[model samples]
Target: MGRIPCCEKDNVKRGQWTPEEDNKLSSYIAQHGTRNWRLIPKHAGLQRCGKSCRLRWTNYLRPDLKHGQFSDSEEHTIVKLHSVVGNRWSLIAAQLPGRTDNDVKNHWNTKLKKKLSGMGIDPVTHKPFSHLMAEIATTLAPPQVAHLAEAALGCFKDEMLHLLTKKRVNFQFQQSNVAPVNTTHDEKDDTVEIIKLNLSRAIQEPDMLPSSKPWDFTGATSANFAGACNAFPGSITGFQYGPSSFGNEGAKSPWSQSMCTGSTCTAGEQQGRLQEKLEDENGGESEGGKEIRNGSSIFNTDCVLWDLPSDDLMNPIV
Candidate 1:
């Protein structure tokens, strides 16, 4: 008996596969199951190698693939998750169920990765600040708000401490606004506006919003937060600073979009020069409000959001 190679050259061919071959290979596996790829073609009457058969089965023929263009939120989640996990398409896919590793890998290479790179975001950092901000806004609730409020207060204290040291040096020579600096102990009335502004900026920033809301400390309020801000040398008046003081409303400022843009927002209006394009398409319709609201509606709650298992599993629908 003459010996032929494991993949008999006479019967087996390599390179591009045809639809008939595809159907035969698919049908054979669908019936008998795929225990051995090398032997599959021999029985299935395919002229392709086992390797080719496997590749076609896993990449294209598999039934589980959820094919289509990725939605905006999926893009956002992918970008944000990618920031933390760089290049791990399998891991990233696990977090986005019904999405295959190959699909995500292709999407990242073809679309999202470039978009993120163009945005000047370090794709390696995996920290999609814009998406991160949206997540914070959508995830945070009243209880979470208190935690963030405290974080802001904490940041305020740190700034005040730094400012005090600077103030002593910078203002020692200049005797302006230094006349008997109201050395009183009234906590509420004797507060300084600068501290309030600094605190608000630190706390309200969308990225920081997550850490601000300490989930463990749920019932924490502004009054209980006095000790938290005690480290702040200057007194704090009221929470006078809101979103408006930041000039965020309707403003195309980067800070406005990065932090102020709500969770449920859409894409078409990301400001910058891109705003003109979006505006033109919408006939000058504002992309800021309705789009964002739509995104928010997609993930109504963290319960639903977190409940979604990552799409990284090999369990394709097929």
Candidate 2:
């Protein structure tokens, strides 16, 4: 009797409630309200333990309880919330209007878990089951296609920084010139001349290539993108804007390997720095000033150079 177990007293009932007992508990709670569990059973004239009374009232006899099968949207919500919160049944139940925690847990264990497993998804991680993917593609994805993913990810980085920085007066600018790539061979004698002109004389800049923008990074983040090295890639061509990159044909920049080194893109950080610089220069935050400052950036090159990258960074594999 000292510890609470919903049935500690010798005189208290232990089995399921009969119709008569249910009525007594329900009717009493209907008028008296739900509070003070220890006092409820005594006041209701029930032979059940105090905690037993509370459980019966909350789980079964509660007037607002939701009943019947869950809807399609409800099921989806459960799966999605479980992925985010993970086994926190109370929190999950709160999101579901009238469903109880015990009900939500039971549904997940019996139905949703099986459903995800059958579809080759691990219910726990909400990702594809490893056995479903027996072999991963071993051959390197074409560098051109893969670089686009990197660029998309880079844009995502920039977008995220802009959000986090709260529109601080800052700017992002980039320019790059393409030079040729030399294989793992000795440095070519004609590397410097290529850098002096845009990509060994006349490769037109692609529409997707990033243009030099003064204070607004919105241009680079847009979807209409086709890129040459004036934006991204590394260690191939004499391109020095986005990163060190190789080109299909042209004189190799001597510093291709050492041209641009970054573990992760710093374009987003550049936004933060520029905001501070502009604000300090103008004596306050500049929402969208057309200061027209064009130069190299953390992820770009200085000077107007249309540096093209290796063909691998632009084309797709067959």
Candidate 3:
């Protein structure tokens, strides 16, 4: 068996359609509706193929066709419909009056696809590109494990901050004694020594006591604390605070440790450990004593304590 040709290539005119051909196609379609596209060209006196005649009439010469630029509403409709139907140009064109399937397909390929891609949306899937990438990443790796690890880190940070704030540990301070100027007059001179103390301490709690709830860093907006959470670690049994060095008084704070029972520990346990550590470390030191607990006994003289405001500590600086 032999295949039949759609049209005779030798006799059919190709390339751009002439004005006469356009007029023929328009007039024939106007007089008689397009029932059979294979017979349209022959009946309309067009030397082009039936397919060519149908395309010319539907895309260009149709009286109901929208000739000018597509309106914003029309463009939006095309995008929405394309998202739902996905490359079914004929179905999309049916909804858009006067728009041919060929025109819609061309617009989608040339402009709409690029626009959607620029907006971080996948034109084919109609989903956010970032979301798609996240799904792919999760599929490749175990997201649960990653989440658990991040939660553990966040819990550790929150625990540390809670302990530091609850204990009311006296931070290290620099003391300077300035002597008053001497007077050479006949009258007696009373000289007073001024002591300057630069103290650093974390913001105190509302009632000057630790809160029952754990300090939450999850609400923080800063990049440093973006993924921080209040989730307690299941593996950690307890926390121990030990003296890193010896004090000049020879009387040092006792080692304090708080044990976590079962799977988790509360913020109170952390605070208890901190309180015990601070008491043992600075219990013997007097108010005017030269030594202070700087969270650790290391560098007894030059320890520096960094203080954070209450609001700033809770909600980190972005």
- Where does candidate 2 have its weakest 10-residue lDDT segment? 129-138
Model 3 C-alpha lDDT per residue in residues 128-202, reported as the tens digit of each score: 332233333334345453453344334333333332234322212112122222232321111110100000001
CA lDDT scores, all candidates in order: 0.45, 0.44, 0.42
lDDT of 1 by residue, 174-223 (tens): 21232322324342222344334433333344343323322111333343
How many clashes show up per model?
Answer: 29, 15, 2
Candidate order (lDDT): 1, 2, 3
Q: What lDDT score goes with residue 143 in model 1?
A: 63
lDDT of 2 by residue, 1-318 (tens): 475554448988878999999999999988898777777787888999888888887677877788888755456556655654568776556555567878899999988775554332446765332211111211224454344434433433333233223333121213433343342223222222222122211122232333342112234432212111222212111222111211222345322322222222223443344333323333353347634333422223431111223221111110
Off by over 4 Å in 2: 1-8, 131-318
Q: Which ten residues in a row have the lowest lDDT in candidate 3?
A: 192-201
For all predicted structures, in order, the TM-scores are: 0.39, 0.41, 0.43
- Scored against the true structure, residue 313 in model 1 reaches a CA lDDT of 13
Clashes, model 1: 29
Best by TM-score: 3
